[model samples]
Target: MKQKSENQKAFPRFLGILVVASLIGGVLGGLSGVAGYFWEDHTAFGAAFAHLLGAASPWAMAACAAVLLGLGLYQYRKSDTAFHGWDGEDEDVMQRAEERLSWALLLDSLTVIVSFFFFNAGTAKLPQSSDGNTITLLVIFLVVIALATLLQQKTVDLTKKMNPEKRGSVYDMKFQERWWESCDEAERRQIGQASYKAYVTVSRFCPYCWGVLLLGNMVFHYGILPSAVVLVIWAVLSVSYTREAIRLGRRGQKTE
Candidate 1:
């Protein structure tokens, strides 16, 4: 209570600092805008863009795709190695490796989606956004998708061989339910911790994102739909969290 009161006492000082900072920022911004209004050679940005976005984008996409594929292959090999070499003794190590492989598999699925996107975007910078380019990109997309899917399946199968209690089919509609139900108490706790962290992170970010979206709508006339969507999501999350907390409290789930 003393610490809280002390901090509260400093609030006016902090508010004064904030006010000063805002004033200085506004003055600097006004001067910069005035300077920009008279400045020529704005086309210098365009001149630099060809080498940056136009030329570098394709290579960047290729590098990203290669790294994703390489990492997936590396993860597969690591899992395969652990699965093959493990005696019954290294259970903890096996568990750690299994966790890493599981996360890698999840990320590799994202990689396939990105491979599709980056390949498409990279190819779009070509001399022509032609039918042939589209066809090639689609082929690349399918190939990566297949490769990522098969690799994940093989990794999961290897993990299952080592531990038969795991359950989930990729194609199953209720896979999350089955997999979650199959989790041991420790795994469930881990999931709970992960979920709480995600919730907290997003909660912290919502205000900043909301402020930025509002600024975007106000300054750029980007429309209220974008900001409204964010608010709707934030509202849903807030209500669900509050409702769950209240329900749990009522059910006597609170710790003593």
Candidate 2:
């Protein structure tokens, strides 16, 4: 039997893939949830499309809460990676980045929920003939999403800056002769390890998180179901993400 290495011990092949699958699933489920909201709001007998599109306060609050809850669960489960494996000079930098990213995600999620609740509660307190309140709140929501995106983007960029040698896909590094040549042995090893660790930590699905937020906005805007099957599809996707993480861990060990 083949001996499993440290990487394998920390991130089993099956579990890694499960995380990846969860990333994909999270993205798809978010999209599906958004679509479902739209369908319910705009179908023939559905809730008024304009009300949703305008992001009536209560609904917005609910949507925000859903996102927070889903992503919060994901992060809570995977946040241990900052200390799970790896050690050496660059380890501190890696851990700091991981923690920073986690907090950022948490902040974004919480802010969204709070904002939604505030907007809805205010709307309910004061009676109004026009939907000025709702529209104003939607605009605010858009701005918040944009700002959140920038913050996350900056956080990811910081990680890249701190670890300059480990950007882009493995294929990109391998195919580019000039870039590969520029790397010294130490740099190469650092890059390789960092890249592999990242593959192992599907700890948070940032892309999917954002995608779901966008989907929510779309649902409110379009008010069309688009598709209901996305949920079922993503249920399977979660498993696939987990599998991919695990497979990458296994592959890294083989290379060692």
Q: Judged by lDDT, which candidate is best?
A: 1
**Candidate 1's residue-wise lDDT over 43-147, tens digit each?**
466446543543444455456667876787787787778767878797887877787687678668767777766665556555653445456556666676777
TM-score of each: 0.66, 0.33
Alpha carbon lDDT at 169, candidate 2: 36
Which portions of model 2 miss their true places by more than 4 Å?
1-94, 109-130, 168-234, 238-256
lDDT of 2 by residue, 131-217 (tens): 666566666666665655555455444445545764443235353454456577986788678755664443344445445554664
Residue-pair clashes per prediction, in order, are 0, 20
**Lowest summed-lDDT stretch of 10 residues in model 1?**
50-59
Kindly report the root-mean-square deviation of model 1 from the true structure over all alpha carbons. Answer: 5.4
Question: Which 10 consecutive positions of candidate 2 have the poorest summed lDDT?
Answer: 223-232
lDDT for residue 206 in candidate 1, whole number 0-100: 85
